[model samples]
Target chain A: EAAVTQSPRNKVAVTGGKVTLSCNQTNNHNNMYWYRQDTGHGLRLIHYSYGAGSTEKGDIPDGYKASRPSQENFSLILELATPSQTSVYFCASGVRGPDTQYFGPGTRLLVL
Target chain B: GDKVKQSPSALSLQEGTNSALRCNFSIAATTVQWFLQNPRGSLINLFYLVPGTKENGRLKSAFDSKESYSTLHIRDAQLEDSGTYFCAAERNNNNAPRFGAGTKLSVKP
Candidate 1:
């Protein structure tokens, strides 16, 4: 089975703090994505990477940044975290074309 | 208007019954994916299609690019199936996928 793991499953941060969520995939997929899930809004894409060193903005990428340093690792960075950014984050990986995506366990963040 | 809209925002069904969830997309979707979010907040992949149909166990899904829509049908619902069902669409030349608000399903015994 494809495996995707995320670090720091739960987190708490204060406003204006810098937060980083890490993701690792053993599937060897070339595409990686970052998304945030809220109560009313299902899942909104924040950032995605095609390959190493390639990051593209998604629908809601205003307060988030993504980095794909290697084929196995992708990270989402919040330079200045805010209370509004408190939501469940998920990372997914997929191969090229219309293939099934493997998602991580997800990380829940609380900005106080 | 929402780009991806799912019908029946919430649903409740008795065990052994069948139900279908639908998703309509305003975008030109080339592919579709279905996910089930358990009560524990873990999102599990159900089906992925490119204008076709796929069946896995008690779950069956169909996607039509021409109609810009997709549907998921559950047969003999079980308590473990109670959760939120989400459909995501990916347009040609677009790597970012758009997700529907999701249909929350509760299977009662």
Candidate 2:
């Protein structure tokens, strides 16, 4: 099984605060993704990276940014957090082709 | 409109029963993947398919690319199977998979 880990399983941030969610994968997968899950919205992609130093916007990327400093690490940054941004975030890693993605436990964020 | 839509948003089943979840795609899906989100909020990969059917233990999943649909069948459902089931579709030219609204399942003893 591919190993994916996320830091700060739970977070509480104030409005306009800077929040960072980190993800690390040991499987050496080239593709990594960040997604947010809401009650009605299943899983909406925020950003993805094909490799190190590459970041691409997804369906919902307006208030989020991603950094892939290394192949094993991907981070999601919220420059100015808001209440609407409070949700569970998940990190996933996969290969470049039609391979299955392995997900991390996920981080729960609350912005007040 | 939803690119990938799942039927029966919620379901309740008794142990030792059988049930099936369906996903319909409006996009030209090339591949499909199913996942189960447990109570602890962890996504577990259930099956990945490419226009074919695959079975594992009491779980079976089938994908038909031509018809743009996928189905997941659970036989003899158990309490441990209670969770939210999600299906994702990968388009031909898109690298990102579009996910459907999950089906929340409750298995009772």
Candidate 3:
């Protein structure tokens, strides 16, 4: 079965601190995505990568950056963590087959 | 306008009853996928539709491209089925997918 795993299941960051959330997938999928889920919003895309060395900003890309170093690894970075950026982050991987996407357990982050 | 809208933001039902959740799209979509987020916060893929209906176990889903809407029907609702459900649609013009806000369902004994 295809699996997508995330590191630091739970994180707490101080204001202005830098935070990195890591994701690794064993599915060999070409597309990977980062999303944040809040209380009101369902899930908003922050960044997406089509392949290694490529990244595209999603609707809510502000305050966040993404990196795809290889087919199996994708990372989301928060340059300066803020209280507003505190939310659960999810990582997903999919192929262009227009098929279903596999999502990770999600990393819960709290910025103080 | 919101790209994707889900109806019945929250629903309450009794065990063994049935209910339906819906998603309406404003951005021309080519593919649709439904998911169930368990209490533990894991989103589980339920169905992937291409303008047609698909059924699995006690769940069924249909995506209508022309009407820009999708429906998920849960039959014989059980306590274990209570969770938040989401539908995401991928536009034909791009790889970007817009997701509905999600419907929270609660099943009572």
Candidate 4:
């Protein structure tokens, strides 16, 4: 089975604070994604990487940035966190598009 | 517009009963994936299909690309199966998947 892990299971940040959520996958998958889950919005993709050193924007890419330094690590960065960004974030890895994706536990962020 | 819509936003079932969850898409979906978000907020992949049906244990899932819909059937529900189920569809190889709002299921003893 694929293993995906996220760091800082819970975070509380002040407005305008810089926050970073880390994700690591052990399956050596080429595709990694970052998503935020809201109460009524389900999951919205923020960013995704096709491979190391590659990042692409998704539906809701504003107020967020992504970095993939290696095949095993992908990170989501919020240079200026806001209350609107307070939601549960998930990380997923897959071998290809439209395929089974393994998701991490999730990170709960509260921006005040 | 909602590209992917899920039916029965919420559901309650008695243990040992059967239920079905459905998702309809407005886009040209080529593949579908189903996931279960547990109470603790872990999303587990249940099935991924390419216009076919797959069964595992008491759960059976079917995806019809031509019909632009998918269904998940759970037989003999258990408390452990209580969670929010989400269905996602991919229009093509280069497109990002669109996710449904999810169906929350509660199995009571």
Candidate 5:
């Protein structure tokens, strides 16, 4: 069974619009991460949350923001969408340290 | 040199054959995790290694922190094993992992 679920399996937004991708996990995991997968590039971490109320910057977090208001939910927000940010986004949840991560079904986004 | 490099960006195998994928880490990785992203786009965890080897069904994995590398072996491959495989490793520094580009495997039955 998948421990994590992501919403808006597919989305399209105009440039400069606000876009948010939501994720929910039933695994009671202490860590959640958002990554973007683009062609020829490995999944780059956009942002991550240590737990409810704790959000941290990841490898590629300049144009993205993450929010974790509750233990079960994590949201990745792109305040001003751009074509460069268009990619497949994935959310993952896992235990505390050095634990295996479980990813949710990806969300494909297009910005024009 | 790349931080993490996986050999053979893609692979094709017969349904009942065997194959091995590899990951070489430039940084001092403390832990490694292997994942299989199915066609439907769900990344399933295959193995998590602190250093050593583990096996599940037809899949086997090995991690050597000293050598900074990991290997995943598939035995008696099946059509259902087709997908992209990824290796993510946590460096010894701040625990951030550098992921390999991935190896896309297509198993024909």
Candidate 6:
């Protein structure tokens, strides 16, 4: 089975504080993604990386940034966290096309 | 406008009953994926289809590219099956998959 693990499974932050969520995949998939899940919006992609040192903005990337320092690790950074940004975040790793993307356990973030 | 739409936003089923979930795509999707988000909030991949049908145990899923739709059938539902089901469509190999609003399913014994 593909292994994808996320750090700080639950987090609480104050408004304007900086927060970071980390993901590590043992599957060695080239593509990694960060998504936030809200009540009705489902999962909205925030950022994605094709490989190490590469990051691309997704549909809703305004409040988030992503970093891929190595093939096995990806991180989502919130420079100025807000209550609006409070949601469940998921990280996934997969190959380029037509393949299964393994997801992490997910992180619950609450901004006050 | 939603690019991917899922029908019956919420559903309830009794134990040993069956249910079906549907997703319609407005985009020219080339692939489809079905996922079940368990109560613990883990997204478990159920099926990945490429314009065809695939069955795993009591769950069967079909993706029709020509029709721009996909369906998931759950048989003999169990309490463990209670969760949110989501379907995603991929326009092409290079583009990211677009997800639907999801179907929240509840199974009771």
DockQ, all models: 0.84, 0.80, 0.81, 0.71, 0.69, 0.73
Candidate 4 per-residue lDDT over residues A1-112, each given as its tens digit:
8999999999999999999999999999999999999988899889999999999998899999999999999999999999999999999998875568889999999999
Q: Which of the two candidates, 2 or 4, achieves a greater DockQ against the reference?
A: 2
What is candidate 6's CAPRI-style docking category based on DockQ?
medium
What local lDDT score does residue A65 receive in model 6, on the 0 to 100 scale?
Answer: 86
Best by lDDT: 2
Worst 10 residues of 5 chain B by lDDT: B90-99
On residues B1-109, what C-alpha lDDT tens digit does candidate 2 reach at each position?
7999998899999999999999999999998999999998889999988899999999999999988899999999999999999999988767778899899999999
Model 3 chain B: which ten-residue window has the lowest total lDDT? B91-100
Those runs of model 6 whose alpha carbons end farther than 4 Å from true positions after fitting are none
| Candidate 1 Cα errors over 4 Å, as ranges | none
Q: What is the C-alpha lDDT of each candidate?
A: 0.94, 0.95, 0.93, 0.93, 0.90, 0.92
What is the docking quality class of candidate 4?
A: medium
Q: What is the lDDT of residue B55 in candidate 1?
A: 97
Which should have the higher lDDT, number 4 or number 6?
A: 4
Indicate the docking level reached by candidate 2: high
Cα RMSD (angstroms) for every candidate in the order listed = 1.0, 0.8, 0.8, 1.2, 1.6, 1.1
Top DockQ model: 1
Residues B14-104 of candidate 6: C-alpha lDDT, one tens digit per residue: 9999989999999999989999999988999999989999999999999999989999999999999999999988778455777898999
Candidate 2's residue-wise lDDT over A1-112, tens digit each? Answer: 8999999899999999999999999999999999999997899999999999999999999999999999999999999999999999999999988788899999999999
Q: Candidates ranked by DockQ, best first?
A: 1, 3, 2, 6, 4, 5
Candidate 1 lDDT, A31-86, residue by residue in tens: 99999999978999999999999999999999898999999999999999999999
Residue A60 C-alpha lDDT in model 4: 93
Worst 10 residues of 2 chain A by lDDT: A93-102
lDDT of 5 by residue, B61-84 (tens): 999999989999999999999999
